[model samples]
Target: MGYAQLVIGPAGSGKSTYCSSLYQHCETVGRTIHMVNLDPAAEHFSYPVSTDIRELISLDDVMEELGMGPNGGLIYCMEHLEDNLDDWLDEQLDGYLDDDYLVFDCPGQIELFTHVPVLRNFVEHLKRKNFNVCAVYFLDSQFVSDVTKYISGCMASLSAMIQLELPHINILSKMDLVSNKKDVEEYLNPEAQVLLSQLNRQMAPKFGKLNKSLAELAAHVFQMSMLSLLFPAKSMA
Candidate 1:
């Protein structure tokens, strides 16, 4: 069976950079991997793309023709992709061997992963093609610096996990940019009580119940094996 990683995150969260880094790392380790560009709006890529959705549908062409904005055009591009999956995606998959590993650098639209059925259908299509797929979600490491932001990130990740229903891997990207590693580490493997106390301190007493509930949920998500803290410095090494 083939192996695939669905690399997804918000815009500017470093999804493309991570994919490029991963490709370089695999090359150094003498492992072969194919990169697939799923972002219709992607202008350039550091890594060579084995398969590109832009070949089938482009955001620029869609926006210019349909007179849609970036967000709407992106959604339109993805929907168009979904419609042609059987024909276009199947032909692309045929180029690779059954054992080949593919990394799909997806668009950064949060709506696509959270509520849309596009990604879910894409994953199912991969499965039908005998590929084991896992979603690698990236969150900006700076979000961990604040208790409220940390909770928001966790909720977003959790939403994707629930929506995609895949073997999920949450990655906190841009660790190298973080100033205080100690502060970030706490939330990496946080305890329920610790997070609750921190949340309580950050918010007013009026938000006590909301803070406690959020902390517990965040703590549970952090404890899962799927949630991994990737340090880019060591990851590239």
Candidate 2:
């Protein structure tokens, strides 16, 4: 049996930085954990990679050979990886020891984790390999300062949680960068009533019903799916 954290988030949400920090912290304390790079477009990463999907299929080659744009090429690249799962990903993971902890730094493509079956299939593969997987989603702290953006992040996260259907964690990344920590404090401890009140003030009163449901959705996933998982990082392994 092995344990894994599937680190996922939007583009520029500090997913790689988080993985690098975790790797460095673990090394500093004399702990063993493998970092796997699942992003084919990843050009520069500081952490040592145990398994890399680019070794199998690269996004650049797909773009050039297939005559596809970046977005289409990325989807195609991931689909190629998905198709080779039984042969490629299986072989890569087979070498890891039982009970070894791994953190997979996945691509930022929202479709892969949201509606697409690709990431879901990837997690299924991990489970078949005896991995206890948790989807760790990172939302940029700066993006969620306002009510509308906050709801957007919440909804996106909830969609990913339901799609993945694994243990989920929502992290507000770049908290340290936000000079006024108090500014983004409400989102950290999401309260339905507070969100609703704020939403009512910002959005038109005619859309009150929509705001309420959105707040309820936000509160439900924030509490039931993610809140409990926001413990000290060192304890995850």
Candidate 3:
């Protein structure tokens, strides 16, 4: 009935910017989409928001009222959102038609998507609402320049894929800022052996086995779990 893209990534990975670009693209093509702000800590937006979770709970309010740190406040805000999904979120969904498309701009907290149950529960809620959901994860193009960083990014993406249990897309964001595009392209769809060789050269010989295993796992994750790698520059252009 409905379609949704859960835009998630680490801090500074350009989730909001991606959402704004997507909104503009859809507008240009004469397609309608609702951009929902799921990040309670978010202060500004370049695109119009159809639904906002900050209406229910906000990290700033939580931190000020409960005397909690930023991380703790974010977790608290998300948990509060989970608690009100049946009420607040359901009400928000009721405003849109069954065929409407929505883009949820989520927080940059890595733990929320990886090991936490909050986002999983949110996804389940969307399913119950008869919405087909897909996760669009972003990684900064700059972050994957080295073998180790590439492996780390792959692992994080894989973790979110397993945890979310939805059709997943990995996007390398901020490609416009990558001066040497070839360096970032190699990690986009690299061979497992190539990654292992690079890792072996960078890491100590004692870490050879670990490096090989990591490279293989990264390759497997990309080949199997990830639907595809998207470059923001090309996609938005």
Best lDDT among the predictions, by candidate number: 3
> Where does the lowest 10-residue lDDT sum fall in candidate 1?
228-237
Predictions: Cα RMSD each: 1.7, 3.0, 1.8
Q: Compared with the true structure, what per-residue lDDT tens digits does model 2 show for residues 1-237?
A: 999999998988888888988898899898899999989999998889999888998899988898999889888888899899999988988898998999999999999899999999999998998999998998888787788998998888888988999988888777667777677776766888998999999988899999999998888776775633322222223
Residue 3, model 3: lDDT of 97
Rank candidates by lDDT, best first: 3, 1, 2
**Model 1 CA deviation exceeding 4 Å by range:** 233-237
lDDT of 2 at 151: 90
lDDT of 2: 0.86
Root-mean-square deviation of Cα positions for candidate 1 versus the true structure, in angstroms: 1.7
Each candidate structure's TM-score, on Cα atoms with residue i matched to residue i, is 0.95, 0.92, 0.95
Q: Residue 150: error of model 2 in Å? A: 0.6
Residues 71-125 of candidate 1 have per-residue lDDT tens digits of: 9999999999999989999999999998999999999999999999999999999
TM-score: the better of candidates 1 and 2:
1
Each candidate's number of clashing pairs is 0, 0, 0
Pitting candidate 1 against candidate 3, the one with the higher lDDT is 3
